[model samples]
Target: MDITDNLAAVRRKKLSRRAFNRTLLSAGVGMVATPLIGTRQVVAQETEQGTIFTWGGYDVGELYTSYEAANGALPNFAIFGGTEEALTKMRGGFTPDIAHPCNAGLKRWVDTGMFQPIDTSRLSNWGDVIPELVAMDGNDAGDGQPWLAPFDWGGTSITYRTDLFELEEEESWDMLWDKRYAGQLGSLASGGDAWWCGAIKAGVPFGEIATDEAFEKISAAMREQRPLIRVYTDDTTTLEQALSSGEMAAAMTWNSSAVALASEGIPVRFARPKEGALTWVCGLMVHKDAPNLDKAYEIIDSLLSVEAGKFMINDYGYGHSNAKSFDQFDAQTLVGLGLSKDPGDILSAGHFMIPQSQEWETRMNETFEMIKAGF
Candidate 1:
């Protein structure tokens, strides 16, 4: 079944509250909905209390154990589906104390002048975070203070059903476009990943993605590949379910999907393509006009804590910013999950998505949507 049908099935199942929460959080579905235009009142009221605008699952109690223990209550939470949506809401005057965005979006977020620099000294666990992560592109300002605190890092590549697809030679991104698996293939819905993967197949370097020729090449490649896709979705749960049920031979996905599927004894593999995986790091940033600055710092530090790091790695199958989190798993286990002992190595091995201008991002997203609509 396609993702739409799978979701219909889930709704019909009438899952228990716990199971339903997991589905919503795991899918990163936004908890609150509002149109892009017009203004709305901020949800939380107390100045001493803070609200976190982040992806769904990050708001769970386990992640904020430290903060909750100290404050005697969990902070207010609002969720966003993606960085662009969160940025749009912020620009529309939604003032959440903290917002989560990936490294690729750091420059764009900073350019908006909506966030403030985090005081690293305030975080007790700051010394233990991977230095390279803290120093990633767009993390630092010219004055030397950092704005984003790196939280979760992972790779983007093909996650395929091992039983249905065989790699005769080196695993390559070309597998997604192989005519033999045309009707069985799937890919991410967003241009952020799909477009870059197309650029890789077109032999366009990450650095040249902004050029007119590179844009044409990437667009053509995607248009050619679109008809092959059985479904396009950001919901990894749907992709995992389809792959497990033998409905899809392959799909472009992150490390977490492969990990989830393999744990369930599904015949799955996260491919290390010849062109390399796309790597990214996402983190938290404080709002420039944050009402509860102290509480925001607590939330950031708690997320970077060793306890939270453990949850991030084991539960979510992502690499944590804290170096000590690697100690939780053995070398072989880490290898099986396609993670290195040092996340810096993973970042170096793949093309870390660079920041693009707002204009470029807008155009690319619109073009990708047109292609997906069979234009």
Candidate 2:
């Protein structure tokens, strides 16, 4: 059958909490919604289709298409420039059914109490996630409810024009603040991740350097590099465009974007750096008052599927949290995706973004503003 015909067949399947398993695996509607190994009770009802909010390059179109093929309806998607932008929209009452944010930022999200616990029992493929990802830190509600379900996980490494900058001698975070490349550097405008970059460059401990004094030093370091930065861009496409034209020689960037650009023959390379790149892990979270809990979980389940994980690694150049997904990849594919066949090696040089209190976030933002204004 054609794509349209398969979708229609999916719609006829009737999504039910209990009947999820009896379905066949034809045309993407093959998800098994059985109860946990020793659990009881039907999972949950499949609510209405949802609108998912996430950063660009996080969730790809294949996920949505696959969901539609399986469930007969597609979730609406809204992409944002950064976690802050998504939060700002949420603050402005632009509620989406699902939101994607990094683990470091989940506390602020949980503080709002606008999220609900993930029903792992309903997630048929939760077992597929790597133990490291599931065990990754997250902000829990005061009552002890976990707020996020992880999807794609990666790092924020320096992406430099290899053809322009030699990686040997300058294979460190100092390249971000090099006077020789002043006014040509690039970084995200968001203070959350950018401040960590600045802090690391100033030789501050990733978790211990949140004081005003340390922030001031970080601010000064950023200010000193102002002459080298041409753009404070958070948009990957725009950054890539600028890099393609040589408008930027180097920048603190998401590792996946750097890999994707290199794939397109942009001659860019991601670095581990002397201080180690600031790593970030993000995941899907259901809204506290989400209108479509069951449907949202279905989407989450689809995301956690090995098939979906394979597509994510191959197409998006991201390292998936699904442990089994890596087994499908060969040596070359692993190298191309900037991953190691061994999980430990992949995480050796990476560091998780430090979760901070709200007060600290405010201080970092204030300091970043001063730095941006040439203070």
Candidate 3:
């Protein structure tokens, strides 16, 4: 290496321990042992370099390992409970460099004109991304570009405590409303997940989910469950902890929550409801007025890396966009995790959320919020 670059690395090293790590990454070296400062916790904290507006669990260090290694610091993060809340905030003039929203909310996120198409060529790992995830319902930005860079994909199902929650029938959506578990049940506060699951329970078809009749049906179901729910939150940690401590017998949660609970030796199962689960793909979008545009691409690239995908799969039990991520696990292992080497195996079995209009989104969020407040 040139003396100029060597001198610069030394200078950066003197700045902070994190910067020293960045220097090593830049020089193509790796630390055999990560320092004790808690890298994942660092993500929950922040750095002023750039900002990633995402859901609660995504701010972990494991998912951003590549970014931290290359940039020396995890980006600043602004957490939102759901995509509806994130879009509402962004529409109200809060713009982060990057934002996360699921595939079902894609059309609404795009209609706002607050985000720009991501140029895949800029991401070094783009070629390795799963095509189906990249071509999510409305993600195309023309000429092979995409509005959102797909990151994680998975199902939203009931993660129930096996020992505490008794199953009378084939694991069904009715478990959440079994009446016996009243005040022992938990649910995600946002309509993004809860309302949809309510729809499944209400027997409202996804194709007709935007109709007025469908709204009434879904709302009624949500209201019925509200009195039964012990807590309503979008914090996966809250749900995980509740399941772990036996505070909640069952909760409507993502696959990751059950995975997290099981790793802690909690007897729990991510339920395969008889009514089918709510499946989704979530990705990152670059804000049209991003303050750190270059860094935004860098962070998105990091999320798409194999390292990030492995952590997502192994730690969080979410399917990653990188096709190569599944290579780390055998077919049987993936099956046990409620996943498959073929994305269609899991997705085709569950109901993919049908994209709705901004009007529907606004109505759903408002209605669900009211139900949650016991209105």
Candidate 4:
């Protein structure tokens, strides 16, 4: 599909709720969506705050309020559909001042030699950031400097409509595999998420995911699912639209989708699969040759602020790295959002994606894409 006009429109500004998901589909990214309460309004201005290469939804004015207060305008942004795509561009010499990639690919990203260790001392809000998130696997860049500044944390699980979808049993990842919902189930296109979810369904442990035997098992499991899925897309808009209209009974989605839908009075459940949910922490990394190094730090500081945390938690339904972000909401409210004051409480209960080699990443993505293509 020639979505150049669509892509250009979405890239020009932050998106509204109605337009957000469709823009996501156009951008070739999936799962992430707009806040249920409102869309972020960004006043476009000349770039004074550097550039942040992130997913489509994070470019809002609210997350950058502190940075904008310090500088005159928000940073220039370049959006990508997924982390893999973001990394591929940067590796090809398209460096942004800051890039957002999650923890699972930390080692491969660090090994790429295009990034520099973030000196935590530059960030004023560093002290208030959650310790565990900061200490995630492969984050520490040797002499105590970290590779990425911890940002949002959340889970990936099935989000299904309670009213329309008949729950044959308590929610399970199997809802996506059920023959009953064949041709009505949606899935993420990126192997970064879906492949890992496949491992879980195939009963392969994260530690053994790279093994030859494990690969065959997961491939078979995915191929079994291929015939059943109506669409394989990363666009949250497409998945959420089908789900909201009752065209799809269930789908594999991030926590953000369910949060947005439930807030709008949609009868949905972000499943608590007996098999653990996939958990992750995505954060910021500075390019080695960041033109706006100081502004990059400023961007990190702004996102780490309690105010940013409040917006991320209250609106997007993701856990924030700033512990103080949880202070604004009462315990019950956080619980209702499927979050906790302590992120560890949630993270520990779920399956964290283990870091993998570049070779493994390439193979997994290739295999999953092949399966999606009916190979």
Pairs in steric clash, model 1: none
Q: Report, for all candidates in order, the number of backbone clashes.
A: 0, 7, 0, 2
* Least well predicted 10-residue stretch by lDDT in candidate 1: 35-44
Output the better candidate (2/3) by TM-score.
Answer: 3
Candidate 3: clashing pairs of residues: none
**What TM-score against the true fold does each predicted structure earn?**
0.86, 0.81, 0.83, 0.87
Ranking by TM-score: 4, 1, 3, 2
Compose the digit string of candidate 1's lDDT tens values, residues 1-375: 323344565779955666667667856644344332223344324444678999767778888889989898888888887668888899999898999888767888999999889888899888899998888876786466799988889888999988899777888998999888888899989787888788888999888889999889988999999989999997777888889988899999888888889889988999999898888888889999998889999999889998998887887778999999899889887888888787777888888788787888888899999999998
lDDT of 4 at 338: 82
Which one wins on TM-score? Answer: 4
Q: What is the C-alpha RMSD of each candidate to the true structure, in Å?
A: 13.2, 14.5, 12.5, 13.5
Off by over 4 Å in 3: 1-48
Off by over 4 Å in 1: 1-49
**lDDT of each residue in 132-187, candidate 4, tens digit only:** 88888888787889999999989999999888678887778888899988998999
lDDT per residue for candidate 2 within 1-375, as digits (tens), equals 322343455598745533344334441442333335223332232234677887765455576655777768777677887656677788888777788877778777777667788877778877766666656555443353356777887677788898987555857888887777777788877887788887788877776777767876887788887767888866777777777778888887776677678778888878778777776667888987777777788778777777777877777667777888889999787876667676656676766676677787777777787777777
Cα deviation at 164, candidate 2, in Å, is 1.1
